[model samples]
Target chain A: SAVISQKPSRDICQRGTSLTIQCQVDSQVTMMFWYRQQPGQSLTLIATANQGSEATYESGFVIDKFPISRPNLTFSTLTVSNMSPEDSSIYLCSVEDRGEKLPHEQYFGPGTRLTVT
Target chain B: DQQVKQNSPSLSVQEGRISILNCDYTNSMFDYFLWYKKYPAEGPTFLISISSIKDKNEDGRFTVFLNKSAKHLSLHIVPSQPGDSAVYFCSVSGSARQLTFGSGTQLTVLP
Candidate 1:
């Protein structure tokens, strides 16, 4: 299992502003994923941050809106730009712990709660 | 379309009883399934998982049953405790690294 942490555990930001959330893992991982959980909704994948490569984002999400950076294997950042009320949600970071024989298991960080005003 | 679905929005069960949570997936290609538990103001915690090759997997008080033919899975917690009250999510993954999650089911264990 991997231990993950995120910065700015909870924040209240004004609309039109951008907020960057940092994710750190105790152990180096190959895949780091960002997710969003809106009120009363399931977790939605935002992007996959791979070390030394550009992040791969899912459909309905764009780079300009949610830019991701992975400088190293153990750290990554996600910036929610031009925030709106709809962007108010819990943003989570996860790391995949790959196994030699079995499939990888994802460990998550305590999410960063963003409430846009 | 939602690939994963948890029909029950919430369930109430008495402490020490069995708490069962069901999930369904539309994608037949999903080969891996997992369950996660979440509390308020926190991220989802990994609870248990089962591979499509197996029909059941057990871990202490929790057990996950997978039915590939039906495209359904369920989580069962025996001797449920009040601490078990939390929202549970069901996730499925095909050949990809990313998982598709279902809308969670809130489990309330009444003491």
Candidate 2:
């Protein structure tokens, strides 16, 4: 298991502003992902942050609206661009560690709670 | 459309009793299923999982059962404790390994 942490655990921002959330993993991992959990909704994956390359965005999510960057294997950032009240949700980062027993198991960070007013 | 579903938004159980949470999926390609527990202000923690080839997997007080034909899954916790009160999410993974999560079921283990 890996220890994951996110910066700016919670934040309040006005609409039309942008906020960047950082996710740091204790160890280098191969697969890093960003997920958003809207109020009363399921966790939806936003993108797969590729180290040293552009991220792969999910359906209904675009790079312009939610840009992602992964400069290294242990660090990544997700910035919500031109935020709106509808974008208020909890953002989480997760890493995949191919353990001997559980290859697909993923460890997550203590999400960032964002409120867009 | 939601590929995975948790019809029950919440469940309450008495302490020292059994707690069961159910989930269903529309995707037959899902090969792995997992259960995650989440507390307020914290990330979801991996609790248990089961493979499509197996019908059941158990870890201590937690047990996960999968039914391929019915496209249904369930998690059972024995001797439920107040500490188990939290939001439980059912997630599934396909060949790509990207997880598809359910809407989550809030379990309240009353003491």
Candidate 3:
């Protein structure tokens, strides 16, 4: 398991503003992902960030709104652009610990709790 | 639509008793299933996992039973301890190996 660190563990931002969350892994990994857990909801995949490529967004998610960047294998960033109150939720970053056959059973970060006002 | 579902929002069991948490998935293509434990303000931790080929898998005091035909699975914890009180999430892995998690069931171990 990798120790994943997320910056700004939490934050409160004004509506229409953006918040960029940072995720750093202790060691190099093959893949990293971003997930969102809205209030009283299940975790939803936002995108898969791979080094040297544009993040692949899931259905109902857009790169323009949730831009992701993985400059290297051990670090990635998710920026919630033009945020709204509805975007308030826990944003988590995870890495696939290839050691498991379930390739993407991710080891998650502490997560960034975002509250939009 | 929720691909994975842990319909039971919460369950309570007495300590030292067996606690059973159930989960169901709509996707039959998921070949691997896993259980993750989550504590408040913390990320989920992997607990146990089972492959579709097997009906059950056990680790220490925790056991996972899968019913492939019914798209259902369960986690059985025998002699449950207070430390077992937490939200349990069921996840299924697709070919991509990306895990799809259930809503989660909060387990409370009563003394």
Cα lDDT computed for each candidate against the true fold = 0.94, 0.95, 0.91
Clashing pairs in 1: none
Better of 2 and 3 by DockQ: 2
Best-to-worst DockQ order: 2, 1, 3
lDDT of 1 by residue, B1-111 (tens): 999999999999999999999999998888889999999977888889998899999999999999988999999999899999999999997788588999999999999
Each candidate's DockQ:
0.79, 0.84, 0.64
Write down the TM-score of every candidate.
0.98, 0.98, 0.97
lDDT of 2 by residue, A1-117 (tens): 999999989999999999999999999997899999999989999999878778999999999999998888899999999999999999999998777785378899999999999
TM-score pick, better of 1 and 3: 1
What DockQ results for candidate 2?
0.84
Between candidates 2 and 3, name the one with more favorable lDDT: 2
TM-score of chain B as predicted in candidate 2:
0.99
User: Taking the tens digit of each residue's C-alpha lDDT, what string does model 1 give over A1-117?
Assistant: 899999999999999999999999999898999999999999999999999999999999999999999999999999999999999999999998797745567889999999999
Clashing pairs in 3: none
- What tens digits encode model 3's per-residue C-alpha lDDT throughout A12-112? 99999999999999999978989998877778889998898888889999989998888888899999999889999999999888774643467999889
Best-matching candidate per lDDT: 2
